[model samples]
Target: MPIFNQSIRRKIVGIALGLIVLMLVTSILSMVMSSQVGILLDELTNRYIPAYGHLARANIRSLERSVALRRMVMMKMQAPSEEEAYAARLREFEEADRKIDDEAEAARTLINAIIDDSRTPSDNAGLARIETRIETALTELRQAMNEDHAKLLKQVDDKQMTEVRGTLEHLDTLRDQFNQRIDTIRADMLKQVFASTRTVIGRQHQAIVISAIVTVLAAIVGFAFALLVSSGITRPVRLLLAGTREVEAGRFDKTITVSTQDEIGELAAAFNRMTEQLRHNERIRETFGRYIDPKVVQGLIDRPEVAIDGERRVMTIMFCDMSGFTSMSEGMTPRGLVRVMNHYFTVMSGPIRGNRGIIDKYIGDAIMSYWGPPFIEEDEQALLAGIAATEMVDQVPALQKQLPDLLGIRAMPAPCDLRIGIATGEVLTGSIGSELMMSFTVMGDAVNLASRLEAVNKVYGTRILISQATADAIGARLELREIDHLAVAGQSAPQPIFEVMARAGALTGAQDSLRAHYAEALAAYRARRFDEARAAFNAALEAVPGDGPSRTMLGRIAQFEAKPPEEGWDGAWRLEQK
Candidate 1:
């Protein structure tokens, strides 16, 4: 153990010598046993296997000859003009007849070879028995069936249908006897093959067992020697590996113990220094990661060039602000306000992050986030944003209760709620700012529309609003109401906007009925059928009297009635102010 701490070269040389001796002994024993097994395999493959295959072929040929004879008879029964088919049948019968004897002779020859070969010990009696069986079976088949086959052919040639059928039956009986005898010989040959195979397997098994025992002994000796001789080197190596794994898992606090004054010890010391640097870098990342999304921070760190050169991509943007939060925070102390704000963001941020939306920034009481690749599936951006909005809305009741609790008060000074707006469109996304400072964010019409829609929530008295693109992307996954088609203050393209009611199945029976009537009312309003639109809106209000869209439409209809809308109104509400 003391010498193990000397030099790595001495330890490696000692391990190498031990392995060489064990491997040499193993190789010698394996070669000896493998030679014996090879002899047995040679006999089985060269003689026993071929003999068995020949016997099987003999049986198949006998069956073929019988079928060919019957086919000849059938062709004879055909019109006398069918000489061509009969001739073909005759050739097939002759071929089958020749192959039967050919296969029989092949088997006989292999069996004789096995009997004479003295290289591998075999059951001579069994080999001779198979040989005799092949001779007797072939002789008997040749004697009895040859004449019967001749009779069958002649009777068919003479168009003797009655005699042909009778002779065919008798020939079939004789053919079956030959096949049975052939089958018995085959069975015996198979037994001989198995016996030979078993002997080879026994040799192989002994070799494997002895080799395994030697291998186990070698492994035990090698591992014990390696651990003993390299204890000083490996222990430090193991500690370094553990430290590396810790660092890989993002925990940089662990440092490898430099246990010896060897090269491994020096490596371990260097590893500790590296880990400390990583720890410092990690602290920086954590400090900044809180201010920016981890993905954005990582993108800038891992691929600064790409992040700087922005790309245009479709994205779903959300602008969610706490309603009445300004008034709510005014009466509270600064510390209390911070506490309320932190709790508010914490409650609101979960749904956004939970649904895979990345928070871009928190501006005052508003949290801006976007959902798209590579954060989430591109097509699912709007749907995910919608689901997040609904989930955030669900968190409102809890926030309403907890804000006062967090402030250690009985109730809040003002009511708090969430107003969310989502828009889906193409946007330029990447790091955007002066060289002195930069922020990873998106800038485009979609971003502007999302902000304006958040403000638009106040005008419609709705909790959530989404642009036509967002609504279309969301499809029917979320329960949505068509609020109005309007071009916001900055954009000339009039886009339809809708309010996210809830999840698809959460709408009640009354809400379901109201949505249908609301759609009809909206269609009539767009058609400029003011009277029909008014009646449909009234019907929609009947389901839910306080429904905002219906009331909004009814008010618009009243204004239209007083003074007709301008020609080519397009039935779109264009916002004159943001």
Candidate 2:
């Protein structure tokens, strides 16, 4: 609670500052350790190593000078009174002596620089004493070698062999002493180099230990702080997720608790309010769902203008009724009858919804559905309606198989089948009841014609009958057989009617021949050629023996032969009952 009292902005800033401080501490600690390491490296490379190199060079030079002096003495003794050879050997000895002096002087200069740059004054004093010792010893050796070399040259020139040999022995001893002093100075420099290296190693070890400790401490603090901050942020998000899952599962009874005054808390409050509103709307939806189709109810809710006022639109309407249902239900119990009807409607309604048709209502053993805009594209309604009818006709065998089991009967005396009619034309569609009980439905000639055609299916002994408008709109999409030109019930004008044979080109073999024969018969009958029409109708029956339209026409032709119409008969038969 105390933590939640702080604003999100303040918490965020605090977390950022904590991380920044941890980083700064790590950086500063590294910088200090690195500076110390750098200083030790500088001393080792720049001063001690260079000083040792110079001292070693001086030692080599002293040995070279001794070798040159001995060579010159041998040359003079071997060629006494050869002044030219003696002079050449004398110059080589002098050059060697000069190089020795230069080397020793360079070594002394480096030692002095080292002493000056030494960290401890006591260490510098000790190094200065060694430098002085090397200088004094080198000077003595150089002077003795020069004097003895000159004396040997003169003795050789004067042909005095005893003096030359004696001078050589003294020169060798001075060279050895000079080498000893150079070695001493070089050894002291080596000690300094090793001592400085050990000190650097110790300091590096200390820096590493200290850095490791500080980094570990910072890691602990940073991780703890980050965990605390992240937990605060993620806890609310998890609660929101749980709440969302509850809403998704259609349980809107729970409300999320707001634990803070931040944005997440405000969002939780809003979500709780939304849940309550949704619960209320859901109740209203359930109440309306019984009286209204779910899709229509949602459509009205989404686009309220559709229910506010009626609109005339071109749509495809279909009426599907169970044939022989009255006969089938006569012996069935009340429970069995209800069960059979429910099973019939359930199995038959699948194709309608599948093809995007909206079931308008169920009247006894009949279902009225329509397809048009707001549910499907207006242009596609007729084709879709035809497809649904074909699929419904296809589902009949399965529904018949299911009905016996549903009614707990082995078999029914009169099995049920579907008679469907579809018509495509302009129709009025919208909410049509009083204010107390409004219903979204379609009304007009198209709707009425679709119903009339459902009944006409029985008259023609056909399963599915579609009006001329619907057939034309459906075009070549469905396999069709022209049934008649009929003036049914309320209308005097004739309308072309057809039976849907199949969804596509499934009526190609004998069925195609049957359709050809039936077309010939219908044309002959329309032309008033009774004998030819009768013969063609019989030929159609031979092609498809149980064909409905061929049988219906054959019977009609017989009646017409018995009592021919007066005049101006356009081959349209008027139905007296729907």
Candidate 3:
């Protein structure tokens, strides 16, 4: 039941633990081997070798000092003209001799220590040779010194002096021989020590090689075990992963059949159950989409988890209704009406989606969509939705032609024209309905205004009507005609609305002139120049009689000029309805 016991994870953990233990053991073995090597080196260098070298060096220094002192004594015995000078030189020689004797004793003690401790025959023989040399040097130096003293006491006789010189020479030769012998002993002892050190180092090297080979072998064995353990986990886990991917891709028939009675098997069972539930859900989605848009249904389905609450985002809402659809449907069979409606919805939905607007819902003979809410890019959404509306209106003529051939039903020469109403404003958008069944939709004053604008398109004989807010959002890219200021049906305020005719390039010269006159009238009205505003409005009507905005402005100017309302009143119009 432990979490780490989960199939693939357990194998990984086991392998990691094994590798860590192996490394720890190998490191400990290496440390033990290194420590043994270090101890052997310490014994050879710090114990017998240094002791032998130290004694040999001490003996050589003592011999050299003794010879120098004896020569000085001889010089003093020959050259002393004054008693004081002779005594000073004699004292110097005596002090030097005392130092020499002290040094020799120290050397003898060190050599004896070496002889006692040395295990090798060569080392013991070297120490013995050094000891004998020290003794011979000491004896020769003493005899030479005594002879010089006797000669000095005999009042500097020639024959005695010659004998003294010969003895001094003999003493020097003896000292030289003693020093050579000590040097040989030092060399021999060093050679023996080096040989021992080399042997110990060779053993240490062999130990290191053995340790490295063992570590490698252990790693190989551990890796094999790790792979075996990992296989038991990875094989089933890989199957599970592959099966999960297939399920994601809608391969519901694919099943994971891993039969290990481990946690992997449990996962495989759980995955199968999950896939079954997904299959049921998919069937529900298909059935639901037959009645409503799948996108809307999906939006509703995703709402709870995503918390798709309403947001106050600037958006363009579009409402399109088939003109005279009620009358048209009344003349057809129920099946025929349904078929035509489906065709209409299909054609319209493409442009809406292509323009990046989500189709919120479709009432009978009408489609409602919006630019924002689950997602939005204000200027781009407004412009594209406007463009899509224009494109849909243009396609109406072609759709009328294709209908008869595709449906095997004689179509009306002029099918009901689409009246599109676009408005931009803040709207509440998300899922709204009972828990048993809900729908994704947008609702607010903006959506209502768009609906009302579609209705007003009947009054203006316009194909597409858009609010000023949408017009402003769309900017100069779309060609528009000032439609009317209408108190659309449900509200107290009137909104200025325009009919989008085409993109800028599609406007005719007359349409352009009417737009220009309407702009002048609107500007004059805003300046509160009732007379000039009326004149401009009349000019717009001359160019396009059905200019809805001009007619609305003319009515406002007449009402104001009659009573000449408040002196400070600006001619700004307001929509009193939705």
Candidate 4:
């Protein structure tokens, strides 16, 4: 098998074999070093570095405990006025003194052990000095405690108590001096240990780095040997694979070349030959750019293997049709018609692309576009498409002058206009048709409804018509006029349709009043108060005469009053249209 197609198990085995060889070589070197040099280093560090520091700390603690016991003994000798108190205090002091003697013996043994461990005089001298200070302080404290105890045994008096206190204070001062000397020696020993440990750690780091360099060099040599053995089969294959990616990215100007005379070399030659056909196809695509949008054409070329039949997803569909094209196209010849159509499409495509809407297909003077399923953003698809549609309609007047010869007499009577319909719902968007020839397109009820509404704009004289679903998704961005609540052909129930007039701009007083009265009417209707709803709808009509939304609401109220709905009726208007 080719190396690029090698299974994960083979890769793992190769890495494991390499690491095992590296570990075996490193282990043998480590063993040899440990026998010759490592043992002596360990002896020097363990015996010399820690020995003096351990002895010093042990001696300090022992002296501190001994002085504490001596003080306790002196206190006990003078503190008891009762016989029981005297005996208990004496026993406590004796126990403390025994503990101190035991600790001192332990320190002696630890110092002796250090002396045995060290091979030099300098290591023993510092420790011996600390031990001598501790022993002198312990002896002085014991002698003072003994003298104070003998004096206090005679009688319990203020004079005897003062003598014991003074002796204990002296023992404390001697113990403090011994502890300070030991602490100073311990500090110096610690500095030496830290310095030694840093040196050892640095040496170990250098050894590991040297070992790593050796292992990497061995691996490189092994890899080169493997490549030399397998070059006849692998080198040409690698070149062929690399050339395939370059050709896939449309860089066919370069050729794949392998000088080896092998079967793999022949395969590389064939692969390069295959790319030449692709290069020819790419040239044809460049020529086809004159007829259709290049982006749409490229999308078709890139995904030729996609299945035509696919599932549907919720998407936003937009249809834009030139309003005055019927009369305008009559005066234009074939060439003039193509020129005018190109200019109209150019203007429309800008806003669509600006808003990230994909141009699905063009139908003469109309455009079918959709948002999502090349990409999807929650709640933003419909809103952006609506904004683009509004801009496209607004640009019709400016675009009309550029097509005067094409428009002829109809241009003077009625300027070119644009009608847009946007609907957001579930739609199948993918490559659709036979395997040999497929186009990226969307199909479903939503797409048909959008197309139907685009046609409906002519009857209503409205520029943009959006379904209630799109309006609800857009939320409060634009002021929408409820155009009708009618059941379109093939739908079972009436759907609320809205016309988007303007976005963000301040609404006129009439528009505000109309909205207020319409909201009130809707609320009353939901509450099953038809008479009240009718009154509110009338107020809305007064504020804005010929208001389509208010008229629809008033009609609904009259219908419901004439024939009341069944019990448990919820006010929900259903839509049955494309």
Candidate 5:
């Protein structure tokens, strides 16, 4: 337990030293067991094998003596007496007899050596008993064979054939009995040899099993010790891991407790400090989150350079102003007006951020938002802006319903409506302000264009209007009606503006027919065919009676009939007011 308080280096060194000692113990124990097998092997090879060979030699010499006796009898019966051959046969017979005794003596001597050996196995006591039996049989066999040999030789010298034949048969009986005894003893010795071999193999297997068991036990003990020693170190690490997970889940308050006086404890202390700093940053983000969009706040907090270093990029900018905000505010008190405005902004703000557009600022009752690069992809900005404008338009009725409850009045003073303007063009985007303060906003012609488009909605009685660049970028995704080609206040070049009617598939059959008729009427009006344009415009009004673009175009056609434009005119109306 005290060891856990030690440094990591000491713990690692202790583990290494203990493992090395365990390895040495396993290896030494294996060697000691292996040496026992080696001793058994030596006894099996030297004692058992040699004794078996000597016994086998004795049996072979017995067979040789039988063959020699047969040759000596044949020599005595040979013609012309054959004294030389008979003498040679006699010598051969004696030599074989002597060899049997010599081989038996050698086997006995080897068996005696084994019995005397303290190093020999105790199980080999059976071999000593077997040796005694073999010795008794050999002694009896020798005495009987010597008597038979003398009697047979005397009978042959006296020329008594019948007695010699009977003696030969008796000698054969003795030989068979002796050979059977030797074979039985040899078989027993062979069994001992096999048993010794099996014992050696079994001991080898046992040694291996014991060594493996010791190794496994040592490993388990070492691992248990390491776990015990590292508990104080690891508990803090587990707390730190849980703390990191909490931070990932956006919870910055979790802190790890320091449990040790080592590096792990120091790490836990640093972790607590890091979480404290994150908590501070989180507070700043929450405070600023009210004035600015959370996305922009997070962007600036994480990557300051994106806002600090300005760049020019094509972005879709939107400006939404409440159409009846001034009149509505005039009817209500300041407190009621604030409630309505806050509620209105809250409803409009969701769709913009939901559609991946960043709300730049709120100018009085209007909201400014943009979509481009870090906020959304360049190609998707126009479409997202259009979708957001349509969503805001859809939210207006709900906002209208909530306004009476919000302001505590039953009858509405003025019907609240949204006038949205969307323009897509190149703009300078980043934090732009004086040294006193800073604001993350966009600038350039597009911002002014979007603002002007919002105002132009009043002229055409349209809820949402978008610049030519936006309509073109958006394509046919939104139901758009081409309103006019106008040069608004600051810009000289006229750009075709479109009115956002509804979502792509939201337009009714009447709306679709109106759009077709309006396109034809606008073409005819641009060509200066007043009569034909008037007819087409009247048809569009029939399809949708209160269609804004057709009514607006018809009014311009009446003015053209009164005073026609010059031949060089390009069907562009100019608005010189800001």
Candidate 6:
């Protein structure tokens, strides 16, 4: 049988045998060089770095010992009669002495390790002698200082000031001697460190020279081998490269021509299959985009990871409900009700989307939406949400006018207005629900608070109620009136709520006075001064007659006079309703 008829693996091995032999020779030479370099690196890490580090630490400890000794002698001479102070200084001096000995011992231990690892252990005998000399000097200095410290304490106890001064002067000399010995040891160790560094550098240079000679020989052989093999496959490779470029440029209508019967031919066949799949995916993407929002569909396509996992982020949420919707829908036929709702949604959704808010869902007459990152910028979410809510309220009159015509009636039986609530806080956002039926939405305290605030509007008779977090986010951009601090049902902490009055600098004169008087009244009521609270609240009513919040406070004050609240009332109205 012909050799070409054998398996492709055997054919490739036969063709490249010369190259394989060359590679083996090169690999063996590399391994030998690697072993030598690795030994040098091991010494660098285990001996040189460690020994240098310990010596440096010994030097620092020696300096600290000098400082501690001087402080001890000064404190003793100044307060020689104070026994308690003298004892504390003595402890400090002992701790310093212990640290100096420990560091010196650590350096000596590392030097011993280096000696054992050395090719010529006798060469380090000089280092050993210097270390011994330094140790002896430190010991003598410590003994002399200890003796003088004891005598100084005795003289202080005996009230002999003259003798105590003399002992302190002796201790100062001992501190100087101790520093000199440590310096000598440090200088010797430094010389050894430099010598080791030079030795490592020399070995590194030798390794590099040997490696270069071997590498040059191997490269020449490898180059000749590569040229022999590459000549046979160049044509097919160029064909495959051209086909890939076409596919990358979105021209998937072509297939690579397979001219070989080897692995290259199989690869070409696979490339054709991949191009066909790419064309099919493009068609599917176009069709899928029509059923889903282009932005949402592209998001899923671009980031498959976010499709299943949820992320926690700070977001602004809004809930808007049509007032008197239940009664308004009672008289309308189902068809007419659907017409009104569709138009209402069409009109309301404009502001939200225009302001970069996501309309999450529509629940009968209510709309839930949110603004946050990945969909909108974080810093602008709150302001966008507030703008959308205010715009929705502003469009209510136009919506009311259009309602009668849409229902084909002379006049609507029930009037319509908006009650909106906005809040900013952390919420979990992602695809929610079972895998079979999932929807992208936000779920957390912020969403619930927004819903509760929408309900609270009925009690306050306010158009919009916003949490303090939301108000703070929209600072200097919108005019706001403090409504009340309320602990809504299912929550423990009282949140201060506010009403959106108008754009900043747009509040009418009368409205501004109403806000001022109500703030004063609310403060008094919180202070538990019912009589003053009542007067201020009455004045607020005069400024804006039929003010719901002001009237609410007045009625509460009457009840408080009859039966006051329990002790520790923080002036927050705890709502029992959901």
The runs of at least 3 residues in candidate 6 whose Cα sits more than 4 Å from the true structure, single-residue gaps closed, are 1-295
For candidate 2, the TM-score is 0.61
Q: Each model's TM-score, in the order given?
A: 0.61, 0.61, 0.53, 0.46, 0.65, 0.51
Residue 245 lDDT (model 4): 78
Q: Is candidate 2 or candidate 5 better by TM-score?
A: 5
Best by TM-score: 5
TM-score of 6: 0.51
lDDT of each: 0.88, 0.83, 0.72, 0.68, 0.88, 0.79
lDDT of 6 by residue, 1-578 (tens): 24423335755676577567776877787787677667666766776567667656666765675566556555656743455666776687678778777876777777776677755222468667756766686678768877886787677667676886777677667766666776777677777777766766776787788778767877787676556455445656787899888987878877887655667667778888888898888678778643434456566677767767878999999999999999999999999999999999889988988897878888989999889878778889988888888888889999999999999888999889999999999999779888688877789999999999999998888988999999999987888888889989889999899998887798888788999998988899999988888898899889889988888889888999999999999999888897
Per-residue lDDT of model 2, residues 48-141, tens digit only: 6777887787777667766776666666667334556657766776777777778767767766876676442226766787788777887777
Expressed as tens digits, the lDDT of each residue in 280-377 for candidate 3 is: 88889899766666666666666664335655667788999988677666667677777888888899888988877787778888998888645555
* Candidate 5 lDDT, 60-88, residue by residue in tens: 88888988898898888766668889889
**Regions of candidate 4 where Cα sits further than 4 Å from its true position:** 1-252, 255-275, 284-306, 374-379, 405-413, 429-440, 477-479, 503-578
Candidate 2 backbone overlaps, count: 0
Candidate 2, residue 24: CA error in Å? 16
Clash totals, every prediction: 0, 0, 11, 1, 0, 0
User: Root-mean-square deviation of each candidate, in angstroms?
Assistant: 28.2, 11.7, 13.3, 25.4, 9.3, 37.1
- Whole-model lDDT, candidate 5? 0.88
- Model 1 root mean square deviation, Cα atoms: 28.2
